[model samples]
Target: MDLAFGADDSKKRKGPSKNWTEREIEEELKKLDAKIEDAKTNSGDVEVRDAILDKAMFLKQEARDYPEAEKVFREAYVKSGGASKKMELLFEILLMNIEKFDIDSVKKDVTLCKQLVDEGADWDKKNKLKIFEGVYCMLIRDLKRAAELFMSSIATFTCVELMEYKDFVFYTVVTAMVTQDRKTIRKEVVHSPDILAVIRDIPFLRQYMESFYNCEYKQFFEAFVEIIDAIKRDKYLQTHANYFIKEMRLVAYRQYLESFKSVTIENMARAFGVQPDFIDKELSNFIYIGKINCKIDKVSGVIESNRPNKKAELFTNTIKSGDALLNRIQKLARALDI
Candidate 1:
């Protein structure tokens, strides 16, 4: 008759048990736990502790146990005294737990960031904190808090030469809020004076000033100055009347042609880059001389030309006059400068 243990007993005697159940695995884990504790107590064996913590963090995350993962990460972070790698790990873990973490928890992270700041972490790390604060405040629509954080970060780098260019970007953000309604024309807008001061001091800012002023005042200042110069040179002196008229007509024609499908006296004057009254006078003279076959549309305030031959004579006369007029203006400019 066979013995009760039989083949299983023989197998167990020959080697380790092959049919180990969950209970046996648990018992083995308990023995490994004691060994881990012994290693932790050994003053020089930090590698084992780090390895164990790494394994724990990995397992917690892989098992989708965020709370446990975060707990292990925090312990690692604290043990490392907020090392850069540790901070990065903390950031990743916290971001994953954002839905479960409340504002208070985020604020705790912020506090940890402050601690890192106090511990003399790198400026880039501090900037990262500021950026996080800014983004969080923006998400909550807390514009004031966001602005404060941005200003603080700006201040931190203000003394550094490399960061000086950021002043313009910072000022732009602040001034946008200061000058909200340009249409109503508030003389007290903070941005206006600052911009004017910048324009006065910075040579390269001339074009920028022109664009800024055009947007704010709805007037092209440089173009207006050119128009004034044209008027002073064109009228009151018949020396270059023909040249001036031609110059004005060509400009007006090009302007009207380019801007609109149709032309008008006022629009033509605008295109000529001169006062409307001046354009009207010149056109009337052309009509009187039978140089241009044109009709004035009273309804649209436009001058329509029907004869292309008239344009040729008018163009020739205008060119002759414009040359003489430009020469005189140049002489006058030189005399004034002298």
Candidate 2:
């Protein structure tokens, strides 16, 4: 009765400890696993399902378990009833695989693209798919196919709401032009007014037109008369002309600089249907403003020139590098923020 309890006896008297052992922790985790499975099977809330799927994907990605991540995405797609967000995620995964340049992966992406296109993906989305196709074609230097796809994407934009689609269209046109396919150029002109405007604005095109007309004056004049008559009869031409003039100046310096190296004032003057003196004056002004470097040929009263800086070249390149006419129209559209 008078004796104090030993430490072991005192511990026994305290009974079981409050802290959980590893076994108990495992048991709790198993219970949580069951609960999560039940929730997944029965959850009607889209947001909750999405959240769970996202968590799973993130965890798998963190674990560097791509197969598991893909499984999660597929489950999410089914669970969410093919939500656009889930579809986008799936597409992004496919895109990443494509970036690896695995031929198998690219073919898979191409198939997916076709499926998506068939599944009523919006025009804007289809345009993106076409861009990927174009990229693939470009990598192989199959420029003709690339240009065709780019043009197709541009056509798709006629139905889409995004301004970026138009930008892509312009870019596609430029890409085609850079490859220097005159047939493609002519086809684009026939199909796209925006392209026509760009062609009309291009210094090289103008020079070509002038030289051609000067060489075949009667036929050129006849065609010119017909065009003028058509424009006079149609109010649309006036609108187009006004719009073209406004945007033409945006690339004028660059266009002039690029063409000046190979084009004479006489060439451009004939192209514009203006006096050679007028062309000379304009050329002098361009030189003064550092838009171009004018090299005068004393005997011929002719000048040769080139862009004095990269900035000017870039502008010209942007305009003329792809589908010239389409790109110009697109640029004009962008400038108007339309």
* Best model number under lDDT: 2
Q: Clashes per prediction?
A: 8, 7
- The lowest-lDDT stretch of 10 consecutive residues in candidate 2 is 1-10
* Candidate 2 residue spans exceeding 4 A from truth: 1-42, 45-49, 56-71, 78-87, 155-175, 178-181, 187-338
- lDDT per residue, candidate 1, 179-211, as tens digits? 233332223222344434543433323332343
TM-scores for the candidates = 0.33, 0.37
Candidate 2, backbone clash total: 7
Where does candidate 1 stray beyond 4 Å? 1-45, 59-61, 82-89, 99-101, 147-338
lDDT of 2 at 290: 64
Q: What is the C-alpha RMSD of each candidate to the true structure, in Å?
A: 29.0, 24.8
